[model samples]
Target: MSDLVAEHRTRSSDWRSRPVTWLVGTGFALAVLSLVGVGLLVVRADRAGQPAFAFLQWNLFLAWIPFVLATCLAAVHHRRGPRPLLWALGGAWLLFLPNAPYILTDFIHLGRRDGAPLWFDAALIGTFAATGLILGLASLLIVHHVVEARSGRVVGWVVAVGSLVLSALGVYLGRFPRFNSWDVITDPNGLIAVVLERLADPLGNPFLLRFGLLMSVLLLGCYLVAWVLGRGILGPLNGRVTR
Candidate 1:
């Protein structure tokens, strides 16, 4: 256990010392900037005496929930906690994880609004969605690394693929059924009933299945692309000389 703790710290420290540190810092800065842009849009709407689409701010906040939970799981890994506890933390993280990327679905809400240019509204939603995706991806990699440390790399990859699939289902539920993460705790029986019904007649709910599959593919592709780009950007830290 002590060895595990030491190893976790060593890796974390190494990450902080490497060029990856700068990249992560810049990513976080951009996310913040995106939020700031959203705020500006809200203010602009208010100045124009228009509905601000304030729900977007709330959606962005919901997106942060999973990211924060994943960060907690990462911190727990460094503590070398019991396996059961760690798994529980990971499960909770997974439950809320879909919320992070769910913002992308908000684009469906985009329409012509009085006093707001359509293009500006589009840009605002796009920024929030992008920031939400970044948060999800960063948190996912954090938890993935923790899994990799304890299990094999193959298991880590398996977990990543499985997570993307499950997250897609989660997003569908949130977007259509209007289910929230807290509903799992507050209305477990009802939620379970709905889930069972859907599973029992998967063909009956073709739209749900198709939506989940499509989202899973989209998220998987984004994660892989970003991961490759991150590696490329941090090639120096990986000890490869890049021209």
Candidate 2:
């Protein structure tokens, strides 16, 4: 009986030591929390006798796309190195990356509803926004690792900063012009035209300039915090797994 117990303990220890175990467990927890946020929206809708913030579900779904892509990209890079497939996944991931942070702009709808109290609505939006931002930051970290592994730390930081800048622009275009990620493919000319029109007269588009700068700064600050905290939290687990 003692031998069996010892063997069981060994098996459990081995399971806990695997990085994949941690990855899957963390993903599962995030998914559960995302569902809980969706549930809150549903409860709000039912109580209000209308579908309030129903779009959050769709937005959250969009936010998950880049996260899923990042997870796949990380797994592929770990197993196969920088293959063409990894680059392809990386490109797709970048396109949808803005969607994750875009949920933050949904706050513009906070007082647009009637039935739900302001506090409840604020909480509902806050839950979704927080989840989306976390998803975005988590995905960014995974891709950052891939870049750092491929090039050097300097190149990694450059790519990360550039990605955040583009993500900020993407969020602006998404909120103001209402262009989806797929527009880059479907409405390339139109998208280019709008961007050029705005760029042609930066002074005339003060709002664009202001929003871009503010959002870029906000994203950069958030990413920096996530990077430092993530390293501190995961460093021990990583050391144990590597050892």
Candidate 3:
């Protein structure tokens, strides 16, 4: 027990020493800002007697669920030897991962409003969606780093590609069928059955296939851009940061 505790402390110390900690901190601050921005939008809408955050409140909540989960998992993954715990956290992270990027779909709600100008609504949705996307990228990078450290580069790439594909499908389920991540826990068999049924006839479900494919591409592209920009920003500190 003493040795286990000591090892955990060492791992925690090592995790805190990494450069990526700053990135995580920045992402969290941005997430808080996004939430605050939405809250202001809701207040403004209410003051104007508009619908006032009927759908966006729920969507933003869902987006934050995955961000918080992934952030927790990122911190936990840095510790060694609790393989089962890591697996459980990783599974949960993947399950809710789609919700982060799912905010992009909220753009469909953008339009003229009673009190707010069209640009205001557009900016509001854009900020939330952009923050969600950044959150997704940050979370994904943390998970990828963890996997790469434990596994190898090839396996890490596999996990990345697989996550993109699966997340795309998850987004489809959430957007069209109105399924939530908890459905997997609440209705495991039903969710599995629906997923299997859909997989069995992927061709028949054209919308699902197309949407999933398109979203996957978009996610991959956005991830690459975010990664490059992050690297560029952190490049100056690379000599001081541990690989």
Candidate 4:
């Protein structure tokens, strides 16, 4: 265990001490990866007749470029935080919960645009929201951990604040009705009487379920994958465990 740990540190040290050229090169590479993810998600969803929101949500949520860059910074910097990791893991679990209803629905061919039991529909919307809220919290933690691990204290704080602001904005948009969204955001299920309708439709509003499955997949699918990758891969890349 000691030797394994030593080897890990060596790699971390090597990367941190590498030339500026390597750092810049790697940053560019990660940027390309980010672009590819966004582009691919968009192209695939569009081809599937999905809404632009799918592409927007996936690309916006994945945030791979910033994630990888922050990981690299964390590796070369402080590299220690208990709360950040806890927030991330816990948030990931919450984000995953929303999918339960979807899973049950699909399992029994009950997840539909038509309608179902009052309780069931409420569960579905609740879960979808839970998933988003959890992921947003997770993103904030991931950013915090990565930035805190890095050297630029001011930059790190900026990143953290920016993440919080973004999450807040997302919640606002999700909850508040928009004047521009009159054509969208209808109510299919209204048990809570508190959940604002969405500004986009999956099967009822503008486009019939021509791609409900695809749209749902785009939102939930990319979100889960990004969450896992950010926490698992990017988190550890910081390469530091303070003693």
Candidate 5:
């Protein structure tokens, strides 16, 4: 019993000394705040006698999946380098990565309902969107570092940019066709058909182009801001971890 306790304490102490601890702690704190915001929305809905914005809860839950995956991938990569397990985790992470930022498009529901005040709904949605965006960016950064460690700096950045581009398309598909990440596995043919039909007529479906471009630009700007802020704040700690 004493040996087990001592081992647990030693492991905890070791984790605290690592930079990823800070990231994980911050992510957890933000997740709690997001959950609180969702709870408040639920309370408001209860009072209003209608189910308004309940979907936010599920959306926020989906948003966390990628962050969790990225954290797991980071831990695996740290322990085992670029092994097959790491690649499998990476694939799953990328598949769900867009979900984190997909909440931003929820702003379209800003004034669509009446159970809650416009201001309150705006604040609630904004809170979830911001939380989701931060989680997404943080995960991307984690993956970026892993890629950089494996490949060169140039390739790392290329992967990062490519991820953003793909995520933008993902957001579009989710918003328009309402395809879930699982659909890729459960209904690949249907998903592919929708994608092809949408792409086959660019002029007829200008909205797809417009939406994708807007989202890509928005994601890129937000990511750049996040990267700069993260570097400014965690530069020394990050250096220590990477070393």
Candidate 6:
């Protein structure tokens, strides 16, 4: 036990010593911003009519949050060299957990609907399929930027290949995704059991996923869009954050 504890401490110290600690701190800060941003969006969603900004944040999460987090985390971990992409893939799904309640309430329309939508099958397909594309494309850009900044050839390649593979898988499984309302967090007296039953089979597939053919086109288009927006426009404004 003592040996194990000492070994753990050694590893912890090594991690702390890494220059990537700053990046890790930045990532955690971004995660906090995501929560705050999402919370505001939820408030807006609960109002009689949702605002465009609300949908923007919501769609940003749906489209890009997972990928942003994945790229950051993967780049940090890629310090060790190319490896399997399981943790980053798993991170995408785990990231969905905290956002589930908001999704049930806002996206699933549990508050307004007496039961789940009839076209749930199509909805899930569109939701998660689009999700994978957004996330995947965002990951590609973020990882590319990080690699350019860090001068890691292998890390860049791993991120490129692994992100693509896991993204493909994310598109596949995320389609037709199922969930349980699991006791509405927003509605106290909500019909928990009925809500669960209603949302249980609600769909979450990608809208343009179409076995990734459509997704590829859309993803590539978005990549160009992001370059224009982030690197071209915003980069000049942000003190020239090169690479």
**Residue ranges of candidate 5 with Cα displaced over 4 Å:** 1-18, 202-204, 236-243
Give the runs in model 1 whose Cα sits over 4 Å from its true position.
Answer: 1-16, 19-27, 231-243
lDDT of each: 0.77, 0.85, 0.74, 0.40, 0.83, 0.44
Candidate 5 local lDDT, 185-216, one digit each (tens): 99999999998887788778778888889999
TM values, all candidates: 0.83, 0.87, 0.81, 0.30, 0.85, 0.35
Write out the backbone clash pairs for model 2.
none
lDDT of 4 by residue, 1-243 (tens): 999999999987765454333335544754554455355445545554653223233333333333343344334434444555635543442232222222222222224323344454344434333433433334344455544554344664565444443333233323233211112235423412323333343234443232334444444555456556544544344443333
Task: Show the colliding residue pairs in model 1.
Answer: none
For model 6, give the 10-residue run with minimal summed lDDT: 233-242
- Check candidate 3 and list the clashing pairs: none
Among all windows of 10 consecutive residues in model 3, the one with the lowest summed lDDT is 234-243
Candidate 4 deviant stretches above 4 angstroms: 1-114, 152-158, 173-243
Best by TM-score: 2
Each candidate's number of clashing pairs is 0, 0, 0, 1, 0, 11
Ranking by lDDT: 2, 5, 1, 3, 6, 4
Clashing pairs in 4: 75-238
How does model 2 fare in lDDT?
0.85
Q: Which runs of model 6 end up more than 4 angstroms from their true locations?
A: 1-138, 146-169, 177-209, 228-243
lDDT of 3 by residue, 164-206 (tens): 7888888888888788899998988888888889879879988
